[model samples]
Target: MKRRRVPALLLDAAAIVAALLDAWVHVDPDDRAAAACALLAAISLTLRRRLPLLTYVLALPAAFVTDAVFATLAALYTLSSLTRRRSLLVVCAAAFVTGDTASWSWPGPEFADLTDSGNLITVTYSLATAAAPVFLGQLVQARRELTVRIAEISKARESERQLLSDSAQAQERARLAREMHDVISHQVSLIAVRAGALQIGNRDPETKEAAATIRRLGVQTLDELRHMVGVLRASGSDPVELTPQPSLTDLPRLVDSSGIEVELHTDLPADLPAAVQRAVYRTVQEALTNVRKHAPGATATIGVHHTGGTLRTTVTNTARTRPALVLPGAHYGLIGLRQRAELLGGTLSAAATPDGGFSLRLELPVQDPG
Candidate 1:
């Protein structure tokens, strides 16, 4: 639950009304000096938020000249709530006590009557009255500070929990990498070696070509596996890359190797940031991969162009010419691509065209070269 805050204007208005009421009870308008001091004190409450000390000083004259003490007490409370200077508060409280107890005479207040027993009781009561607002103000200040400290503690605990969760995830990834390296890699290696042997032994042109393609793809898979293993082995504390990440320069090779009819066109600047280039490349790669999985025997077009400070990339594919194979997929590729684009201060959008085609568009802001 949250607390509703009072409007400053309303609070100031209330303080002014309270001060004027106190004046009505204790001050006589016939005495111009007392009336003027009380009115000045009432008006000074508006400045309490910005200049608490000044407001307190301005309001003190009313406590000395007349019995109207509401404005002076309000100013004191405001000052105590905002400032941390204990000694200054003590002095101001003492000044308020003295002003409330002394008698107004000639040029200044007379304290001769304070020596009497009755006057001493009056002084003690004045001291108690002054301490009331100070204690209340200090309590409010402490509560405000405690709220801020609690918020900071909550944020710290949340960060700690996230770090622990990430550590557990990293451990799982490492275990999976070990399994792939020790088992899957061995099987793939055997396949590649046998494929190579068949390509060499067979004289038939079609068989040799198929064996060669298998060997090539197996070797590429092995390279990617090695990279993935390295990434898994390295934790967040120490980042290590076994192979360079793909970027715009690799887009052409990626399109060619995708095994789909893709027409690539790019008109990007040569000096784009590496992060921006990688984001564009990944967005295109994921779009093309989705096309391959969902739209079999489809022709695709990829267009990447830079205009002003914006980089735009679009991937579109025609409707499938053949039925899509029932392949197992988590369907997280586009979600991951959209998150990546957002991380780079960019956007990713995908939709089905009116012609029964799929289209993906990515737009990113580029940093100025100069």
Candidate 2:
């Protein structure tokens, strides 16, 4: 599978071959005995990845009786790499010592000094040689595990960065939506009301000139709205057009264009935060727009009062004698205006007044003098 596993496979194949050849040529006289030992060792090597302890058990007998050194080394490597049990390793070491002792004691060709206890030196040499394969396998296994852990950590960090990017984009989208709703809805409502008044008063030339000016203003507002929409759609690729934003100062112009005489009363402070001013402006604009659409030819009055570190605005309009044609209502503009107010820690309410009219009220906190 992996390139690293190829070397382990080659090593296992070589070990099996060496054990079979040694048994056949030097240790076992019978052909069947050597073949059986070779087959068992090969099978144990293959199963070592899944059952390391079992491989050690199968290789111990051949290692002790016939000096199958390759079989012993392969089993030891598999056991050390695949198993985490320390008790099992101690048991395997005991089995190896006992098997090698039994094989050395057996009467055979006395090539070395047997009486002088020099055989123990051979046994120690064989044990150390067998340990080499086990150490190599353990090192390889540890490196592979460390590589895998580092890769997982990198992936997790990448996922967190992507999530933060998505959250920032979503926040920007919501801000753009709120701005578009506040700007376009107020301007369009004023245009509609002024156009209706100009159509009704056809006898006066001055009224016609004023209506023409209102029409030009409406067109300019629409163009600005389109540019804002384009910038929002393109994201950072297009720069936002820095047109003048309507603050609380523009409230008088909004009332003038509504085609209804609005009696204004005020007690607002000299200066306020930019966000508070914009929020108050939009709240009044939305309320007056509702008044013009729902109640035609009615006298509307706006009241602004600053008290207890809060600015409060109220817009009330009387019902007309003749019922006006109600405009097609999408209802999202009011909800968005309310959300804008709440975002600035303010409150807004709209309801039918007791005096046969509609009333809209908004209250926003004002910063105290530094």
Candidate 3:
């Protein structure tokens, strides 16, 4: 029977009917003490499950003295079903059962005694009657425990499946990043190179401005592409081998091809790691391109300093003499530059100066720590 408020009441009704029947059929109406004892056991069965062993304690004497099988049987079943300790259930049930059937009036007491001859059938019959509820109750208890264990296993498996799915998505993202870098890096670089060449060939006020705008847009696009590639890599996607990135050696060509006036100063270490040189070149490229976009016809200064284990680079541009169209860049150039600097254990900063000019700075460690 289910343990619920309504079901408990219903169980009480069923027990009452069974108890009344057994009491009326087994106990003589003239026997007041026996009828009272049966009534007491029936009342105790009402809360047999609610009180645990307490109801069993009260029911035992009435069960052994009278023949109210319903109350005693229900009490025994509830105890066996609710109690967790196997040894306690076994001991209690055995004691209750032994006393319950000891005073039989059939064939009778002596012939059906525990060690009496031809008494095995009746003794076994009594044992079976007492054991039925306990057996069934234990069976239901085992089924409930099994159901709980199965549910736990199902939850664990589902969690494991979700983890695997997430891992797969991360790997896919990384692969996409790598492939993007491979496919777009060369084409974007070519656009920047062509724009820079055009700026050098045309020096007219409007032509120079247009050429610079083209170069600036190309570089900004490259910065966005790099940022996207970084995102893909972060997500765990692997890309194919890519073209070599620009480094310190490429800085002179980068500046000379820009077609804008620029002054350079350097004390950079002769032997610098490729990563540090790449970060320095990229930072300079981003700063110079930003100047071209925001302040066309501006003269810029590039500085590289080597001090012990750290390297510093700075790019500063004079106030604008020509204004270029302010193209909509998703603020990706600075983000790309920052990512590059951080990847090399370095920092990059860019800000407007008091003189209405712009300045960009990068600092990096000589050795790779990653």
Q: In terms of TM-score, which candidate is strongest?
A: 1
Q: Which ten residues in a row have the lowest lDDT in candidate 2?
A: 103-112
Q: Give the poorly placed runs of model 2, Cα more than 4 Å off.
A: 1-203, 206-210, 237-243
Output the number of the lDDT-best candidate.
1
Ranking by lDDT: 1, 3, 2
In model 3, the Cα lDDT at residue 308 comes to 68
lDDT of 2 by residue, 85-144 (tens): 656766676566656555344465234344656786876765666556666767867887
True lDDT of residue 368, candidate 2 = 62
Q: What TM-score goes with each of the models?
A: 0.62, 0.51, 0.54
Off by over 4 Å in 3: 1-13, 104-112, 115-118, 203-214, 223-370
Query: Which parts of model 1 have CA positions greater than 4 angstroms off?
Result: 1-6, 112-117, 202-210, 230-370
Scanning candidate 1 in windows of ten residues, the lowest lDDT window is 1-10
lDDT of 1 by residue, 1-370 (tens): 1233467777889999999999999999899999999999999998999999999999999998899999999999999999999999999999998888877788876883766999889999999999999999999999999999999999999999999999998999889899989999999999999999999999999789778877987899899889888888776757766567777999988887677889999987788888898888888888887888899989999999988788999999999999998898998988998998899888999999988899999989886567
lDDT winner between 1 and 3, please give it: 1
